[model samples]
Target: MPLSESTVLISEVGPRDGLQSVKSVMPTAAKCAWIDALHAAGLREIEIGSFVPARRLPQMADVADVVRHALALPGWTVMALVPNLQGAEAALATGVHKLTLPVSASEAHSLANVRKTRADMLAELRRIVALRDAQAPAVRIEVGLSTAFGCTLQGPVPEDEVLRLAEAAAAAGVDEVGLSDTTGMAQPAQVRRLFTRLRAALGERAGAAHLHNTRGLGLANCLAAYEAGVRTFDSSQAGLGGCPYAPGASGNVVTEDLVFMFEAMGIATGVDLEALLAARAPLRAGLPGEPLYGMLPEAGLPLGFTYADGRLPRTPSIPRQAAA
Candidate 1:
């Protein structure tokens, strides 16, 4: 089913971004189960995995199988992350609905994360776009300006550079460009200003807000993004991941808490909070003994709480991160 105009599009990245940080590989069957549960809970867009070398990210070795499984689900938008033209080719072959690439605004981070200078990455983006235009014209390509706010390796990314990259990405024929708080150095003030500038610069082509909860301000930054007219968001289930390349960059905005915040404020997230909370079970089963983050699971919904669309509340049930 198509989302209503008021619905906030939350792209769940637990399977891709979340798993890439972990050492243990989640069994293929378990990954499918977790994704199935998420889809059942009304999450329409999901980044199932990345198209990287298995030796580098063994956790995602079964990405193609995961994509095939996710594609079987009706009305689901299955996305995948690709670091270069090579990765993009693999993802495109899997028939993914969308492909997201990370382009850092910080020069140091660009080298560290993708081993490419900003200009090289732009060249890569153009190559990927050309390939998509020829091979899979229907697939959408999105670029996330990673380390847009700040960088641990480089420290304090400039706003002008970020906007410049966004313009470059748009000019490269990407469907959209969004800002990512890759190192979790963003404050609410900074988030608002950047996203506001993003909208002003890219208009409808401005994409999701991929915020991190590293400093415990994930929700605050998310709200700031919303207030700045950002409707799409990228979150991880159970707050499962962060940038493995970004030192000390831990925690993604928790999907459960994010959904609750929007739903409680009379904003339609279109996610069934109870169902979303229940999806945590499969994740836990997949990664035994892994510590999950998110306050909504630990604390049940408040009394008489109602969703934005007037969905009645239910009593809740409950449920992080490490090396690159």
Candidate 2:
């Protein structure tokens, strides 16, 4: 499960990040079905769920079961979020391929989200790394520096603080450190600037772009990050999740729209736009009445649209927009 250079890795976080934000908990069977559909759509990496206490977050009470089911899917790199050493231990025991820790750049946001300061989180990361070395040497550890862009709790997080935290996380022995727009306040210019600085600072250890579309800038920020040399992107199907801990936080980058944007431009994402849209069925079925979001699903494909891999439409016709 090393990072693939063949296609931009779209790490789906709907199961973990998405569900956790919602009030209703999806059934275990439905979670598996949704995940299976995502795999069918060519999503190779998925954050199945978090390993936090069930009482704390009942939505993820069956995370271990979900992880086991995702593991059974071949050629998939299953990941789970772990807030601390305890969560990491439980996640490792389930044989998750990777573990992602959220380390917030904003001290106030960090305290609100994980009840730990930046220094305490780093110390926890060291302990988790040591445990990983001892028990699961093959498992990769990633840190999503949440609130890297900005925070609702602490208006604007300084760029220097983000870089400092990223460097600190790298030194704590994690495999990669990525930035998170937990509060959805990132603009395209800021995205490019920070990612560029991150690459310059962390080199290969700098990780994915976890942007939000709160201000309708998710795809734009992603494009900016791509320009800044970030190949991995985190998105949610139907735009399902945001940080529950961060006030007024909402909207993850929509997966179908993201794939469509890249494929329409002839940048292969290795994801089938049709299949990805179809995956939304199980998501809706799992959480009945829940609102789903995405433009491509409603607009349908353009006339004679061709995927980057050269797949043709089933029945090409004049584009509706053009015909109108």
lDDT of 2 by residue, 92-141 (tens): 99999999999999999989999999999999999999999999999999
Off by over 4 Å in 1: 1-6, 314-324
Task: Write down the TM-score of every candidate.
Answer: 0.96, 0.96
lDDT of each: 0.92, 0.93
Which is the leading candidate under TM-score? 2
Q: 37-72, model 1: which lDDT tens digit per residue?
A: 999999989999999999888998999999999999
Q: Which stretches of model 2 miss by more than 4 angstroms?
A: 1-6, 315-324
Top lDDT: which candidate number?
2
Candidate 2: lDDT over CA atoms? 0.93
